[model samples]
Target: MSGPSPAPAASDGITPLQQMVASCSGAILTSLFVTPLDVVKIRLQAQENPFPKGKSFVYCNGLMDHICVCENGNTKAWYKAPSHFNGTMDAFVKIVRHEGIKALWSGLPPTLVMAVPATVIYFTCYDQLCAVLRVRMGDWAQEAPLLAGAIARVGSSTMISPLELIRTKLQSQKQSYRELTDCIRAAVQSEGWLSLWRGLGPTLLRDVPFSAMYWYNYEKSKSWLCERYNTKEPTLAVAFISGAVSGSIASTVTLPFDVVKTRRQLELGELQAKNLSYQVSSSTFSVMSRIVAQGGFGGLFAGFLPRLIRVVPACAVMISTYEFGKAFFRKHNQERLRGPLQTRNT
Candidate 1:
């Protein structure tokens, strides 16, 4: 049999509600810090090279064309580069200079709405599932963090995918959305409630593998680091570094899925507007094929650099805050309940 099932952290008496709340709290705080990078990533992903004679979004065509037409840059295929954003710092500079600081937070509302609940569901389910898997698998269960993470993501993603779709729609828009509610209302009114889940297939494809790789890498890294340092608990530095490394690995592996998901969702919106059937771009394979046909392999990795930059810190903050939040809240809750109970007894 296995050595023993992993025990829940109960420094202050763990509860399901408390677990969910702590996860949500951590995600919300991280979201605020990461929202700007998120916007740049989304904008970069949504943009298409207009110079390429195809169905691309052609966002920077005018500017690029103006440059080429006027100054005549050496490389005619300079626009063939994967995405408009050169790097993280360049993305920030270009977005702020061109679109204004406010644009960097364009989809914050919908993202916040989704992220809290998504994190809550994901973390709670991950812990619960891990416990169950450990009981069944014994010693081998600890080696299966990827399985636990994938299972947990399924539950969380199914619940929150609609919100993810909405957030993507809002964020990837070339035009501004007044608010989250406006975007939701438009989706509902135009394409019925089903529109909210238009790209769930691709979301699952992206997220399931991403979560599996991320959680597995993180757990492995954390375990190694803790053992190397001979610590019972991971230090903040350890957690941050582990989380960042894991996030980067997972993100790079699953970036193509992310690109396909965004394209499918963006196309879904257009199809809905035109009242066309799903055949325009129905399947993930079809979308992938089209992307390859148009832009070659580079299309699959659009916005990778900015995504990497955003995800590393975002993942580090998320996991670190989650661990800290759980500890802090548990202690706080214990003291809060003790105070009330002690007064009543006195």
Candidate 2:
């Protein structure tokens, strides 16, 4: 009888740059995709400034408790919709086109600077903690449902908040802050350092679930694809599918958190000083309740439809491109390995 064939080994062709590009490109694509929705979201969020309609949106809302604007197409905020996407694309393309290859990486520096440490800490902390939990819980380990994903997300996200705060403020309006430095100076001079961490609480809450669901779906989908296809190796297509599923799962759990976070950030001037209420119920329920009390529940979900529409394609493209690039690198590495082997054998 023939001996059983040895099992195929997992491919080690993946590179660090491939991994980073795949991950970061997913994020960048997500930003591009949801940008229009982000603009609408921001306008809706900034209405919290307690200002009357038709005035310039500003950083403050302490002048009043709340201000209501009719949800009509004619609203002044409607005109500003182009600012987010237009400005980002404009900035991104210009930076890439003119700034040599390094320009695409300019905005990326702060992002990576923040994201890398956050990711490292998240994975390390969550894994270490979960390992401890598993040892303690014994049979109850499965019950945890990968709970560490959320915690890890928060752990990493904490480091990323300042960069995100700065990026969002800059992206919200192009001309307002001449450059990143200008945005920082203006936000600090006018809004205070707290402005840099705007909506931090809600952001963590959002990220926790977002990360949890992302990891859960990714692992599940990847396993399913591998098993169902009965293949030793799955392609980048599988990765994108898994990523998209994870993104969808994450978005649902964290969306309301995003809504509240946006509102909080836009109204940073008011929430900064007196957060007694914030400390108590920064939980998701309270955030919804407060928005409803001010503008009704419908107001809370105002831009959700557009958000779903924008996110799906953006995420698909983003995830797909990242996976494709990763696959390309994997193929290149495979060729590299085989080339030397073939030459030596010859």
Among the numbered candidates, top lDDT falls to 1
Candidate 1: TM-score? 0.70
Best by TM-score: 1
RMSD of each: 8.3, 10.1
Candidate 2 local lDDT, 154-206, one digit each (tens): 66666667766655444333335457687578779997887777656776776
Give model 2's TM-score versus the native structure: 0.56
Which runs in model 1 stand beyond 4 Å of their true positions? 1-6, 9-12, 40-104, 163-197, 273-277, 330-346
Clashes in predicted model 1 = 2
lDDT of each: 0.66, 0.51
Per-candidate clashes come to 2, 0
- The sequence of per-residue lDDT tens digits that candidate 1 reaches over residues 120-218 is 889888867766676678668765678889999888878876755554444334335567678688779999988776666877899899989998888
